[model samples]
Target: MPASSHRPSPASPLEDDNLLPQILLRLPPDPSSLPRASLACTRWRDHVANPGFRRRFRLHHRRNPPLLGFFDGCGSLDFHPTLEAPERFSLKRDEGDGVRRPLGCRHGLVLLLVPKPLQVIVWDPVTGDQHRLDVPQGLTMNECYESVINGAVLRAAAGDAEHFKVVMVAADGDGVENRRAVACVYSSETGAWGGFVTAPIPYDADAHASGLFWRFSTSIYIDHAMLAGDSLYWQLIGNFEGILQFDLERQSLSVMSVPVPIYSKGNCFKLMRAEGGGGIGFLLMSNSDYIAQLWRRKTDSDGVA
Candidate 1:
């Protein structure tokens, strides 16, 4: 046999152009996975950096993206990384002189409410892209109570990652008996704010009948927009404690009272998606009993479990 016949082949499956990408696609969907792999050699770096490979990597792990980190959204916009050491991703930014409160985070976008000028800042931490949108006329600070301004940010379409939309909800009241919940949406693709959708806040029947004007100071809690089905939910605080529902498809706003009365002090509750992708629900923790209860919204009726 010739000497050349005894030599090993130049290409293996791992080194093959066609098979290399398929192997790389199976890498764990961590923020630092690709970057760490790229440090191996020049070829691996080029393979991971390719636009097509990047897109495929995202889609391949779309179902369960890594929990990169979370924003505190308390007094400032701070991102606390969950990944350890080398894999940690930092998103620290100068909030400037104006106070910025996080409204909600969804679909890889963060919604922030700037109180001074009354605008929402749509921020993408990964790409460092920001889109500042002025508050809609109906939900502006002048039009609605500034303290109750809350909103949500989500992608325009499920598969469309580049563009997003913002839904801002605020409580409009006359400080007497006339109180309404107003919402307006902003679309990135259209670059315009949609018309206002208003829903009257149900008055306290007992107070109204007693000849005393129902004046409950209501405000939407910040940084907790829970999306279920085609709608978003937020917890309402103040004299009226309930869950505010915003239907994305119908562009309507409604309120649902909680299963039990939520006391103003030491009330710990969070809205969440029910198990098996059922519907919106909430986990309530009793301060005194030190026990947790999971309540699922009944699909058949307006009751809570």
Candidate 2:
């Protein structure tokens, strides 16, 4: 055999055993790239698809995360979270023929409410897996315009498969100028829409009688809720004193007072998981300045923050 014939082909950095993790760590945060990268070769595919690799990839990105994407009422918006140039791509629909807009986005899943028949679709943009959920019975076709609907998507467990819960709050005006309203919830695991757990939203009685409540109701509808711990916190549009709280575990409803008053739009408040582990926390941003205040619910304190 000729000596030249015995020489090996050019070495690929990917072929280096010690450099495998380093190579994988540099991959884009988008899940769409996983399948294509796996197809590079059998060994590469297995390593890329490995459970541990996926977990580590998630952690790495969490620390130095890329811009996966974001959404608005119009449609899904994709932009790089970091300074890197944004990747160009279009979102694919697993089902439905007509146009559907995003109603809620969380836990990497976009909850889309389709018009015409009024259906709820939970889509995992990463896995391309989708679930067409049943709309709440209380949400009637005719009453749609008269009601306020708020929804949130929650992952049942972290780092798990398609297990999730979709909660919807349909509040209908009592015709008393928005001082009174009714609401309901729908759960995916139980496959049922729960009953109406109504509550009276705080209103300025003196101002309400003067028709101020009616005018305020036009702009100050209850919407944009946040999920933390076992409760969902909904901000009152015009009211800065309190927030509507729904306990998912108890299926009960109550009103919670804010630590400080806020008059700006509801975007100033947010609910997030506690970093120390367990419970939830509230992030209230100051309107006058760039400062943000965080209040955490104590695990043993029974809803006290």
Tell me, by lDDT, which candidate is best. 1
Candidate 1 Cα deviation (angstroms), residue 171: 1.1
lDDT for 146 (candidate 1): 46
Q: TM-score for every candidate vs. truth?
A: 0.80, 0.63
Candidate 2's residue-wise lDDT over 94-200, tens digit each? 45435665666776677776654666777766666678876666553236642356667777655544467776654445443554434566556676767777666
| Range of the 10 consecutive residues with the lowest summed lDDT in candidate 2 | 211-220
* CA lDDT, candidate 2, residue 24: 80
- Per-model lDDT: 0.74, 0.60
Clashes of 1: 0
Clash count list over all predictions = 0, 1
TM-score of 1: 0.80
lDDT of 2: 0.60
Question: After superposition on all CA atoms, what RMSD does each candidate show versus the true structure?
Answer: 4.4, 7.3
Error of 2 at 277 (Å): 9.3
Which pairs clash (backbone N, Cα, C closer than 3 Å) in model 2? 67-81
- Report the lDDT of model 1 for residue 87: 37
